[model samples]
Target: MKPEDIQIGKLVRKTETSSPLVECFDMKTNTCPIYMCCGLKGALSQAVGAFYGALDRYTLEDVITSENRAMLQHILLRSKLQPAAGDQDEVPDLMQGVP
Candidate 1:
């Protein structure tokens, strides 16, 4: 399937700014606040890293390797959607930068 064809939760009619981060709505439940719910985070991060690396004219062999792509796929598979019960709480860990 194409990248766009891959359903990472819902597209969320509202599109945020261009970056590694993307905001999506949980169609399964509407009461949930705006939170990160997509499976494309790892892949998106790698892509951004690559773009910046290229723009800076860096010649690193491992930057765009197949292993990096596989890592992204793994992250997507491991991330499961578990709804939040009770009040809307903020998760500070989600704000951490990519390693």
Candidate 2:
């Protein structure tokens, strides 16, 4: 089948193309625009690259991993224990310590 015939977000095996394809996301447009006709291999590589880039930039605190999820949950649960009696320190005095 031709690349134009395929819908966006549909993944196909790499062997079925005449040329390579490149995967790209247009953030300003808020759409993923894939260029076809480069062959399935190149397209697949681009898709893989995009995926890895996202995964790499995503932090553990973003709750991407099980450990992160558990840690966040624990923080939430612990926060409910008690309120501070005195005036709490507004900000950390980071300048007082060595980096």
Candidate 3:
């Protein structure tokens, strides 16, 4: 399917996980002192889950729309880190009208 044909808003799914950073931390070496009573880990996990859920709603086309493209360009120009001259040409010409 064409990128533009997909609906950006429909891809997101909301779900919660009971364990947050438990999988990341090693029990033997990186064990948290308050592992048993730590609410922060679960909360952090839920926050990350929510972030991904929100991000899932956008398609490539939705993110690269004309308005968004312009906004991105504007932000990039305003930022201190400018793209290299050679790298500028590597950017996809998504602004071009597709047949």
Candidate 4:
């Protein structure tokens, strides 16, 4: 699908990340006594808007390139096979970075 066809902001609208950039942004749920006077909320709101705007500009098509997908699969597989952080040296290089 085209990037603009995807609305990530709408998809995540009910999540905490949708508007809780600062407690002051959500009046109904905000418990902070000084929320009315908090100037930081405006800046944070703008920042969050920009964040969602950026996310909404792209689709999964923009992120999951084959090369990157293969790399991610390799990393996930490597994690499953490795013993522990300290035993990383003993882990085999499975697929030699291929998936």
Candidate 5:
């Protein structure tokens, strides 16, 4: 599908994306003792609304522009052409710093 027609928020939701940065924001999983009067919950709720609002404003086309598309395509093609540095099942060296 064309990037221009993709609604980011809808795409994310369709994939069941989990924005789990703030654990307390999830009503089903929330176990905070101060559920009734927590300022963080109010702030996080607003943040989540703002997040989706921003997502709704743009399509995938907004992120991958005409100029960047060529570069991205080149990189994608190059990656496909090259053999992997190590075992196919193993993590790449670039991410060795990660746990």
Candidate 6:
């Protein structure tokens, strides 16, 4: 999905300006007890890491702009294609059709 399709919440906090760290929480509430142990958290952590890593390297005037948003999206997409920690050879081809 394009970045425009997603909604970014308020700035929760900023650790630094030069290498700024911003945190946003999903407004949607999920009451699932297993959330803490879920794969979703791991994936999100990876995505957030990649996003901040990019911010550290580039000086973006407007992060929500189409260009910047696309860059972030690309980072997320690339992260998904990578093999999970210590599971290089066992990684499944995500492009394959599921039966």
> Runs in model 1 with CA error above 4 Å?
1-21, 24-37, 58-99
C-alpha root-mean-square deviation, each candidate: 16.0, 20.1, 9.6, 11.4, 10.9, 15.9
**TM-score against native, each model:** 0.24, 0.28, 0.40, 0.51, 0.54, 0.30
Model 1: how far residue 60 lies from native, Å: 20
Q: Is candidate 3 or candidate 5 better by lDDT?
A: 5
- List the candidate 5 regions with Cα displacement exceeding 4 Å: 70-99
> How do these models rank on TM-score, best leading?
5, 4, 3, 6, 2, 1
- For residue 92, model 6's alpha carbon misses the true position, in angstroms, by 46
Clashing pairs in 1: none
- Prediction 5 global C-alpha lDDT: 0.60
Best of the candidates, lDDT: 5
Query: What TM-score would you give candidate 6 relative to the actual structure?
Result: 0.30
Cα lDDT for residue 64, candidate 5: 71
- Please give, for residues 1-99, the per-residue lDDT of candidate 1 as tens digits: 234232222212112222223333233444425345645655766875665555444222224356575675566447733323342432222112223
lDDT of 6 by residue, 33-63 (tens): 6665666666677887776665554322234
In model 6, where do residues sit more than 4 Å from their true spots? Answer: 1-30, 60-99
- Residue pair clashes in candidate 3: none
Clashes of 2: 5
- Write one digit per residue (lDDT tens) for candidate 2, span 10-96: 222121233224323323343343333335555667776686566555432332255454564556455532223342423222112
Candidate 2: regions farther than 4 A off = 1-38, 64-99
How many pairs of residues collide in model 6? 0
State the lDDT at 26 in candidate 3. Answer: 48
Q: What TM value does model 4 have?
A: 0.51
Full-model lDDT for every candidate: 0.38, 0.37, 0.51, 0.57, 0.60, 0.41
lDDT of 4: 0.57
